[model samples]
Target: MSTLTKQDPFSRLLESAPTNFTAARILAKECYLAQGIPLAKAEEYKFTNVGKKLEQNITNFFNADSFEVSEELIKSSIFEGFKGDVLVFSNGKFLPAHSAKIKGIEVSVLSEKSDLALGSIAKPEKDPFAALNQASFENGIFISIPKKAQILKPILLLFFNQANEGQVIQPRVWIEAGDFAEVTFIEQSVSLGETAYFVNKVVELKGGINTQLHYYRLQNEGKPVLEVSNIESDIQKDARFTSVTISLSGDLVRNNLSFNLLGSNSEGNMYGIYLLNGKSHVDNHTNVDHTIPHAESHELYKGILADQSRGVFNGKIFVRQDAQKTNAFQQNNNILLSDDAIINTKPQLEIWADDVKCSHGCTVGQLDEEALFYLQARGIDKMQAKGLLLYAFAGEVLEKIQEESFRTYCDTLIQERLGSKF
Candidate 1:
């Protein structure tokens, strides 16, 4: 995926006389050629050295003709208590046989005509990964909800990568919620084991007038995986869009999330929790654009780094000049347990409207010894008290989830990740 020079991997790919190239792919290729991959030195990607990783594993492109999915794998992929239509994708290609038949919503593939999906990807001329994904995306899902539809159940997108040959997996998803519609979507990326694999994922969210949509993503890839993902959203008038990302395990993971409040009175809420151990690395960069008046956006992200792992969080909230009376808030907090753990947190706010109220802050610290001691004084052991305090600290972000089962599952996972301190 290196866009460094004329002899980069993508250029080498072009020299191989690639065939069956779609118009979108051609455009993306041109964009990549115009603007190469952003190096680690680049200001935008300075914290995460994705360019270096790509340079090291440049030839691991997608080459599988097809794949086989075991029934046990499918069963294990879905949560035990989750009640929803599971949409399955194996190695970037959608599997209709394993996926449930979605009802009440229209689903299709993203083609050149799908502007709503393609437009959010932006010009690859500036974003190398966007160009790469647009050019290399194998299968993309376009989902549309009808007006006034109250979708009670959730739609789980289970992306399973079976990288036997160490291939590239790019997944793109576009969702459009109709006016006054309410729906929830869960996107979970998983791999069977550790391997030298690269997964590039992009998601587009559109909220219509008065629509309320909940978007949740869980990344549980194994240690041998490197993932780069982006999420773009558009919210309409009186609409409410909420997103939560729970990152558990990955060798190298970077998530770029952005949203635009196009209509007045629209609300956006973004939340994330990342638990990293071993030598894992996870970076979450988020931005919310307020283009309309009277809009509001709130964000909160927390990270727990253990062992020699590292985590980075950069959040931005922008209030346009015309966005008067806007209310925007952002926060990022990190907990470093081991002496070898590292965390970099930055919260940014850009306000051009004089009538708007905006605030941003970030905190990086270890567990409070006083709180642990307080819990220990109440008859709890030291290690157990620390675990309980850690759980309570992380629970501040998890408790906001509306779904009971999903929230419980996340809470349980966090507790398990806390493990035994002693």
Candidate 2:
């Protein structure tokens, strides 16, 4: 780990990191101490400046071991069934009453007894956010899926930042899929009040040989909330991993997603859409690393920024020396509905393999005036025409959502963003 000078604010935060005699906890603490809050002005974080905001909210959020949960609040948060597939957390504490047990999968609160299992795939020492999660998280979910078992329904991990006032909350989750296993995981973040709060979350997943893992992450934290989330996954031979992230609303949201193709013939697909308004800000940074032959990865992200909102998309793809016959593609498209809206996007590729084929590009354009005019030449009104064109532009990515219920839910949010009644 690189060293940080005394002036760095994160250095002070490391001094207060919780200490434990366990090796896992010790490694996490040591990582944070050695490299606090990433290097100052690092290129990877050129657009998002989160170091100060993290320092401001770290104290009140990390120290407390517990908080209160409302039964009514929990019920209202569930838009779907209360079956065994739901896992509920409020202010980073898991609630057994709201969470039901599912069959064929082992889900337990992360404890010292199984610290070794938690960090096998997700290395906390590699990233600052991961390190903080391991060092201080009070409760987290450790999930293991058996080989050859396919769960038809998607498991939902719901989080609520209730009664947070101005405090920040951090939650951690780890998931492992056995060979030939199939599973879908969804994580949704929402809030109930207009009060300002912050959430720092960490999640790590690994797919065994020939496994199938589909992950959907939605950040619809209503208003006056800041969220910074990190997701890391390792894909094995002949395995497949699909990630769909939807960012509807937030004061400030940053998603750090990374996928490592460790085995031959592995595949990864990463897609995202963000509908932003107000003075909100959202940044997505994704990295896909291919280490073996015949691996493939694709990334496509789209954003609709209006009012004074801002959006950022940065994607990096790495092809190792041994990763021959690799195929990779990356693209980011954005639309700015207002003059005040802003977007920053970059598509980067680092290849050490000469036989691989890779391409990357980004597009930032306003709503097509010609298309809107053509629609208005018909019977549609101006506002309706604008809405229609924006929807069509965003429809491609939206069509890829596999779950019907989740797709409809995202449609409702996108309609709300477009000021549509439906």
Candidate 3:
């Protein structure tokens, strides 16, 4: 069965193009012009509408300048002084001057010939957004942690918008952790303006044998911006990788995440919570691929949609041949605050391995009326009663977060969304 009944015309252009350039600048421009912003008719883009938003010729307005960001702006968006190496990008350009170095990590801005040193990291061949990011990125941060090294502090990558005038920006990040390396990383994206613009960013991560990574992404871009992110992680044998995403703001947001278990005895976990209100739209699309034997993966995504907002969750797990003993489970649950609120959730599993255990499920409904009424009967007002019920709904996912600070931050965000003093 085909996901789409019709073929996409833009895909044809990519089929005819050459694949030699590392950045593929010209190819991306050609695709942008030929496709002229994809519509729902596009096969892979059936659920997204940014292609329609790009018709404003905003990409052409991007310009590179020797810009500098102020200290006040950095302090305003900083994520609690994480201990590991820190890389700061103001707008689209990397600011090495603002970055702090660590003893055991190698971090720098990517330029020509740097890819030679960043071994075994496969650059995408057909992803136009990846190509566009590579071509237009003023500077990209590249991190390499040596084998057997454990980072003491979480590496922070902060993307701050310093542009006085609103402009479209694309930033790229590439990371490689060697065998036996262990690290924790946190990425926070904050915009300064109420300007209307688009952000198409990509982050690629690679973990070698026996490696471990704890990754977290926090996005708070306000109401006028469109936030789109592509996060892909490749895990090797006997390795562990975890990704946590907490979505709180953005007029329209989409996160595409994928995890590949390429070696035996590898494990992966994907956890996310999104809070939506007003007329906002938040979508989370993810896939977990188990290709080797004795691999395991678990995914749970929960959302709180209020007002007339909409939320979407699509998760798929694939187990390939010879991937015996594969264990995978996926679940998506949501609480809709109003009759006007909407949620679309789909959980899927495709297994070619006969000796595996896999299951998936989803639920979309209002808060538990009994629980709300019980709280209300205990002297709680209608709004406060609903807030208590909704908070408990998302607390299951929040409890899994290991870092106390991150957990507390997410708690405060949830409280603010509920608009209750408690």
Q: What is the lDDT of residue 246 in candidate 3?
A: 87
Sort by lDDT, best first. Answer: 1, 2, 3
Ordering by TM-score? 1, 2, 3
**Considering TM-score, which of the candidate structures 1 and 2 is the better prediction for this target?**
1
Error of model 2, residue 43, in angstroms: 2.3
At residue 409, what lDDT does model 1 achieve?
77
Clashing pairs in 2: none
Candidate 2 weakest lDDT stretch, 10 residues? 57-66
Error of 1 at 74 (Å): 1.3
Q: Which digits, one per residue and each the tens of the lDDT, describe model 2 over residues 370-395?
A: 98899789878888888877777777
Q: For candidate 3, lDDT tens digit of each residue in 1-422?
A: 11111443334334444333344545454544444444567645566665655443233346334357777877766645233556788775678899887788888776633434221332333345554454455556778899999886777787876443435566777788999999888888777667766677778899999998988888778677776777888999999999989888887787888898999999999999999888888889898989999999999999998898888898989999889999998999998887899888888898899999999999888778798788888898999887777788878888767666667777787877775556
Candidate 1 lDDT over residue span 54-155, tens digit each:
667646454333378877888887776898888878787777777777788887655433445364434456467777777766566778899999999988
TM-score for candidate 1 = 0.93
Misplaced by over 4 Å in model 2 are: 1-21, 38-40, 55-65, 68-71, 80-84, 420-422
Return the number of clashes found in candidate 1. Answer: 0
Model 3 TM-score on a 0 to 1 scale? 0.88
RMSD of each: 2.5, 2.7, 4.5
